[model samples]
Target chain A: QKEVEQDPGPLSVPEGAIVSLNCTYSNSAFQYFMWYRQYSRKGPELLMYTYSSGNKEDGRFTAQVDKSSKYISLFIRDSQPSDSATYLCAMSRGDSNYQLIWGAGTKLIIKP
Target chain B: DTAVSQTPKYLVTQMGNDKSIKCEQNLGHDTMYWYKQDSKKFLKIMFSYNNKELIINETVPNRFSPKSPDKAHLNLHINSLELGDSAVYFCASSWGQGGADTQYFGPGTRLTVL
Candidate 1:
């Protein structure tokens, strides 16, 4: 099984809707969790970052990590068309190397 | 100003040819990374350098090479490119090698190997 698993969803939702994107990993050693947003033809950009099992909120985005279940989620409130992009979840063991294991991104579309 | 930048934004090369992608960061970061995003949009780290020293090297083929001449520059050179080499390459930089360090990414280089 892959270390990280995420549904590659082209999930479509109306503007102002709440969107949830999630990822699950098999490794319990992952301590640093991150969410990245990638626009078409562009590189992935860091959106949200959280350490260990907790929730971090920034603007309309919230990142939640549950170490017990090896799950992570990014919640978007009042989603906008500008939010339409691919959401990727990444995690690392916080080791000296700091190598990240990535999830296959889920494509999200916010309709007007 | 762009924190990270890559040259040759788009490359279309024939199979068996050799090409290179250059990455530079003005962020004065100590760590730099090279990642490959396949057609399925799965990102995989190929190599990483910290302070111009190789730190992380994945199981990539020898045909792929990464060079770090300085802390701000990491270049990837691909020899004998195959059709499977067609993918978007990204360069990222961080202040440190710690896992909690936030990575800043550059505009990707789209390589089309035909």
Candidate 2:
């Protein structure tokens, strides 16, 4: 089984709508969680980052991680067409290796 | 300016052929990584280098080799490429291999093998 699992969503939402993207992991050793946005034919861009089991907010985006549940989420407020992109959740355990395990990206489309 | 860059943004080759994708990062980062995004959009780490030294090498096949000429460059070479090698390869770099500090990714190279 993949360490991280995420729905490969083609979720479409109208502009200004709130969007929630999530991922689940089997490894409780994961301590750092991150959300990345990737546009068509482009590399993944870092969107939100959180450490362990708490919520971190930056502007209209919020990242929440529940270590006990091994679940993480990325929330986008006032979503725009420009925000349309694949959202990928990634995690890693610190101190030993720096390699991050990734999930299959969820494709998101924002309607204008 | 492109902080991290990869050559041959689109690579098309046939099976049994040998090819290499070159990557360079201008962010002055000590650590660099190579990741593969399969058709299912599953991104997996292939290799990583820190300051011209080999660090993290995943469970990749021996046919897939990564070379780092310096701290700023990490290149991937595939010998006897197979059809399963068709995927987008991305190069990324981080300021340090620590903390929640994010790694910056380069525009990926899409490889299509016949």
Candidate 3:
């Protein structure tokens, strides 16, 4: 089984909608969780990151991790057209920062 | 300055051809990695190097080798590439092996094997 699993979503939402993207993992050892945004033809850009299980807020994005359930989420408050891209959830265990288990990205399309 | 960069934004080659993708990071990071993104967009780690030392090899085929001349550069060379080898490849680098260390990625190279 893949360590990380995410729905490959073409999640479409109207402007200003609250968008929630999620991922689940089987490894209980994962302590670092991250969310990355990848636009067309570009690399994955780190959007929100958190250590262990907690909440970290930055601008309109909030990253929540539940270590107990091995689940992570990325929430967008004011979704915009520019926010339309692929969202990928990545996590790593202990000191293996060089190895990140990535999920199949979820494509989000925000309507104008 | 670009933190991470890759050459040949797009490559089209025939099957059985050998090609190498070059990567460089100016972030002063000691660790570098190579990841493959398939058509389904599943990003998988192929190899990693720290200080020019091979640290992690994810059972990638011997035909696929990663060369690191230094901490700042990591290159992937695939020999006799197959049609399945056509995918987007990404290079990334980070400072340390910490839970909080942020990894920066380079613009991916889209490889098309005919």
Best by TM-score: 1
Better of 1 and 2 by TM-score: 1
User: Tens digit of lDDT per residue, candidate 1, span B1-114?
Assistant: 999999999999999999999999999999999999998999999999999999999999999999998899999999999999999999999987865678899999999999
Model 2 Cα lDDT, one tens digit per residue, B1-114? 899999989999999999999999999999999999998888888888889887888899999999999999999999999998899999999976752458899999999999
Q: What is the lDDT of every predicted structure here?
A: 0.94, 0.90, 0.90
Residue range A58-112, candidate 2, lDDT tens digits: 9999999988888999999999999999999988886545678788989999999
Q: For residue A87, what is the lDDT in candidate 3?
A: 97
After superposing candidate 3 on the true structure, give the runs of residues whose Cα lies further than 4 Å from its correct spot: A96-98, B98-100
Q: Give lDDT: candidate 1, residue A55.
A: 95
List clashing residue pairs in candidate 3.
none
Superposed by TM-score, candidate 1 places the C-alpha of residue B49 at a distance from the truth, in angstroms, of 0.3
lDDT of 1 at B56: 93
User: lDDT: which candidate is best?
Assistant: 1
User: For candidate 1, what is the recovered fraction of reference interface contacts?
Assistant: 0.77
Task: For each candidate, report its DockQ versus the true two-chain complex.
Answer: 0.79, 0.62, 0.63
